[model samples]
Target: MTSVRVAGVGLTPFGDHGDRAGRDLFAEAAAAAIDDAEIDRAAVDQLAYGNFMGALAEQQGHQAPLMAEAAGLDCPATRYEEACASAGVAVKAAVEAIRAGTADLVVAGGMERMNCLDTGEATEALAIAADELYEVRAGMTFPSAYALMAQAYFDRFGGGRADLAHIAVKNHANAVPNEYAQYQREITVDDALDAPPVAEPLHLYDACPITDGASAVVLASEEYVTANDLDAPVEITGVGQGGDRLALQDRDAIAETPAATEAAEVAYADSGITAADIDVAEVHDCFTIAEAMALESLGIADSGEGIVAARDGKTTPDGDCPVNLSGGLKAKGHPVGATGGSQIAELTRLLRGDHPNSEHVADATTGVAHNAGGTVASAVVHVLEVAE
Candidate 1:
């Protein structure tokens, strides 16, 4: 199989883009990536785009061709929608295409204009990612759904608000230096604990904000990279995906996401790297509780020990392993479809020693990106390393 590498990455600052269309945002990111790769627009062989709720958010569908045209690329284009894991899946497809010798150069990314909808409308649109009959019909929004998970985690692990508060504080601090982050201000644990409650055990600070953004990456086969002399490319060593029951209630353990664990396992196996070998990571932290669960799922911490790791500073930049140097979804913003691409972009930047955060892991060589969709029903994990 052919090896794949990320030659370039780009992203628009994640926030409320009042009137910006998803296509326009994606075009900007795509162009930036193309420029960063120093590749001609006509050289892109294919495009893999991810967008969730574009039809509902903007009453637009069939966005693949539209985005490709907007980016000035005349190429075959396809869209992947797996809720928040959309971009992760898109990246996986691009990698697979290159490995299979189907395409030598591909532009893969995601975009979402979630701010176009009102609060209630946005809530409804996001809820559609869950099991409509079992989860959404019961009037369970994401915050409430994850609130139950938070409560269950505390019940099983014996931690409370203060434990989760650490995640909010740490991620907020990390975001301060990230210009592309949605929330750049630092907050204290008290600020997180005192914030208005969105759900019991889950405060406003625990939840990621409603955001609109886009992120893109240029991927090329090793053969193409060598021929084109692309500089400082980051090799994609492993990619894995997993799925589970869609409804949160169907899982035997509400506090855990087996899909994430399974995906990480496959990625680690493919890369010949263990959890301890990962110098840094970017995981889905849609909620503070989600981050704790992700840490456990990714095997960075044992079951029910993720909160302990967070509180003990084990996951901080100066700790055993730095997680979410990009501020994660909590502070960097979660644009649903765009988030996975953003995560990969951040990891690529870190591996290239170009991350905006000065606190990024020193001499980091290996990194992992974990992206989940809709209550962890679907997940994708990728292991990346600096070119050897």
Candidate 2:
């Protein structure tokens, strides 16, 4: 295989896009990324788009072609959907395409226009990822599914609502300065305590908002980067992915994400760096419980101790091994498909010294993006470094 380098990254603001469609949002972000790369659109040999609800939201299928025409690109296109992990999967596809010598330059991105639906309609749309035979029939929503995991973790361990609330406070505080984040204001512990309940243990604050946004990145082969004089490229050092049983009932333990653990093992091995070496991370925080679980799953913290770590300010924006400096999906908004690319864009900015929240992981040279699809059914872990 060959090495891949990220040449440019682009992102749309994370919030409600009143009337913008997925095609429009994606095209705008893709154009910015291509421009940022200082490359011609015609040079792109492939396009990979990440979106979970094109069929539901836009009543549009064949998304890749739609996006291609919108972006005015004539390359072969592929649409990727791994639920919330869509953009991460698209990023992985772009990397693999370059590594396999199938394409030297590829544009990978994600877009979601979720503001079109009301809460009930949105919940129904998201329910498609659940097990129709079991989960959906049981009237379980995403928050309820994750709330089950939270309840199990608390039962097995000793934490409670207070621990989860702390995670909210910290990430909210971190989101204050993130201009692109969905929730940009800081919230107090009382604010968290008073938020409307979404699920028993998960509240409005604990859950990410339905956001509409898009993000894009340009990936090129190492040979292409060198020949084209791509400046300040970030090297894709390691990539790992794993999948698990879709239904939560099939798992032996809700506290553990076996797919995440396996992916982390491969990421650590391939990157030649342990969790200790990672200066910063952008992990999936679709729910506050997932944030704590992710720290453990990534081996950044021991199992059942992620709450303690968060409570102790160990995962604060300026804390050691800061996680989710982009305000995370918690504060940054989970635009379903666009989330993973959003993480990469934030990390890329951090590496380029363009990010204002430099204190999160100052002097950081290594970064990680841990993305998961539908209740840990799929996961992709990536390690990156400042290119040589």
Candidate 3:
């Protein structure tokens, strides 16, 4: 019944680290988080590491213990994997552990060393996160899944490729001020339209990059926070998760993210806050179309109105209900397993008002972070409030 607060947040730059391995990056980010929290290594009772592709990429399967040993933190640790929602799942688990009085301090992190393989190999490895028997075996790539969703949106909403293009342009523009973003270069909607097609209706500019990165956070109970005098702590007011049918064919419509909507509904009820109370949000924008769908799922926009809202500058960094001020997965790079952790880290910075691009959102007392996994089959939503 107790509240959990973030004592510290840390992240390595989100980019392709040609020589770094996932374990190495995880250790670095974990150490940084421990230092930031000013908590002794021994105080960390548990370690929850989120990683989706270590086995396929490096044949490094046992990650939690390996990460703990590499970081020199002799604590019980476990690996969490819900595809790209891995880190967000870890966050929820860490909070639950604290609420259950099982641990006072824990380290939650995610790491992905992509770019170690060629595009084909990388895509094959990532496909393991999907429903292999039904989806991957049927030859459906992630982009194809999203492309179907984009077409559905257009067909149902009267918007087409142009709407998705606007999302790409807006998010890239938002990324320029974010030092950790993978794509900081601003692009015009015309540029997006002209880009090569990755999948039908989804151009190169609409997709997130294959990134390598790590992120970490120190989670502590509210009692522990006050006892330790943590600096600028932020309480996790709500945490909820929901799952949908694994195969895209099982869903009634491709455009609607049912899991995201269900998760957000649970989170809003638990936190006693409506979408209107959210000052800033970090939504999963793995694809341009995903961003628009997220807006609808979060109830921030009516169905099919997300693109219009975004194009009207409503989702701009300084605009009403700013979304993805951290550049989002689209421009910030999507390191699969590490993405959810990175999203929370960005929110931590926003909560502390320490993000370099401070003008993005003003006086954000409450914020939300949403992440989805496996073609929106699973989702995790959380609401954070500034520590009183």
lDDT of each: 0.91, 0.86, 0.87
Quote the positional error of residue 68 for candidate 1 in Å: 0.5
How badly does each model clash, as a count of residue pairs? 0, 0, 0
Instruction: Point out the higher-scoring one by lDDT: 1 or 3.
Output: 1
Model 2 poorest ten-residue lDDT run: 353-362
| lDDT (tens digit, per residue) of candidate 3 on 159-184 | 77787888888878878888888888
Clash pairs detected, candidate 1 = none
Better of 2 and 3 by lDDT: 3
| Tens-digit lDDT track of model 1 for 67-150 | 999999999999999999999999999999999999999999999998888889999999999988888888999999999999
Residue 78 CA displacement from its true place in model 1, Å: 0.7
Model 1 / residue 182 / CA error / Å: 0.7
Question: Across residues 100-156, which tens digit of lDDT does each residue of candidate 2 receive?
Answer: 899999999899988898889988898888799999999989999999988888888
User: In candidate 3, which residue ranges exceed 4 Å CA deviation?
Assistant: none
Badly placed stretches (over 4 Å) of model 1 are none
Residue 308, candidate 2: alpha-carbon lDDT: 75
Question: Which residue pairs clash in candidate 2?
Answer: none
